[model samples]
Target: MKNQTKWKISTLISLICLIIPFSIYSLWIYVFNLGTTQAERVSVFKDYFPDFLDGRWSTTIFSIIFSISAVILSSINLKHLKKIWKLINIIILILSGILLFLNLFSMM
Candidate 1:
């Protein structure tokens, strides 16, 4: 009972970490597209970015940071989870890896 509760809590935490970064990125994209001009979108992100950093780099950095965090959290709980939950954790890890890969590739 207690063990199951712990797994549930960890699973919920893992799910939140998995979703939040991508949700924030998607929101950024939505807002960017809604702008009247490309300059408007660029200016908005540029205002907060350092002179040396641009949108792609900032996005890749954010993705790597958040995905690594999700990977760590999912791995910590993985062994204690049930079979179906184990599969879910594996999927999350894989997706996070893919996210990191694509982001890094874009930086090239």
Candidate 2:
């Protein structure tokens, strides 16, 4: 039971690590733009946000998909646990955190 709870909490943390950043980022762009076209949104973020969001919508879509998948799989099947996978999960979580910190409320 303890293990399950720990794993569940860890998984939830991982999900938040992914979702919160992406949500804040997309919302940041949408909020600033309010109702702009694709090109306009890209231009604004490029000028202000200054990241891949400017170069390609494909990049945005890719990040969103991967982040969402990581969130979903956090609570998924635990039967296949392996050391390598755990390390990878940690890396993914850290990357998500970095993205989140970089995007919103960082100023750092």
Candidate 3:
């Protein structure tokens, strides 16, 4: 049972690392529409993104890299993992909250 738990944790860490890169790639594909035209983009994937979004891919890509690195580091240094995760969560939560607020304000 204990070994299974450890394996689950290890798998989780790997999965988390992959998610960040995958999200960034998805966002990149959304913004650039690389190898895809406007008419094709909508047919391919329009439901995932907000209609209001201006496609700022650079910001999102950097954020993904930073987030993934933070998680990987925390996983390695389990002793400080809680503190690191808290900080990361707070930063992302506040940033997203501010973005959502500003967007709503702009629309109003």
> What TM value does model 1 have?
0.65
Please tell me which predicted candidate would have the highest lDDT against the true structure: 1
* Better structure of 1 and 3 per TM-score: 1
Candidate 1 residues lying further than 4 Å off, grouped into runs, are 28-32, 35-38, 44-59
Candidate 2 Cα RMSD (Å): 10.6
Q: Candidate 3 at 91: error in angstroms?
A: 31
Per residue, candidate 3 scores C-alpha lDDT tens digits across 1-108 of 675456446545544554554564456566665436775654344445555533545335444554555445434434333554445544444443443343345335
Model 2 residue pairs with clashes: none
**Residue runs of model 2 more than 4 Å from their true location after superposition:** 17-38, 48-54, 58-62, 75-108
Q: Whose TM-score is higher: candidate 2's or candidate 3's?
A: 2
lDDT tens readout by residue for model 2, 1-108: 667667656666666557645764776666566546766655555565445555545345545555655644653523434465566566665666466345333332
Candidate numbers sorted by lDDT from highest down = 1, 2, 3
Q: Considering TM-score, where higher is better, how would the candidates rank from best to worst?
A: 1, 2, 3
Structural similarity to truth (TM-score) of each candidate: 0.65, 0.41, 0.33
- Full-model lDDT for every candidate: 0.73, 0.56, 0.48
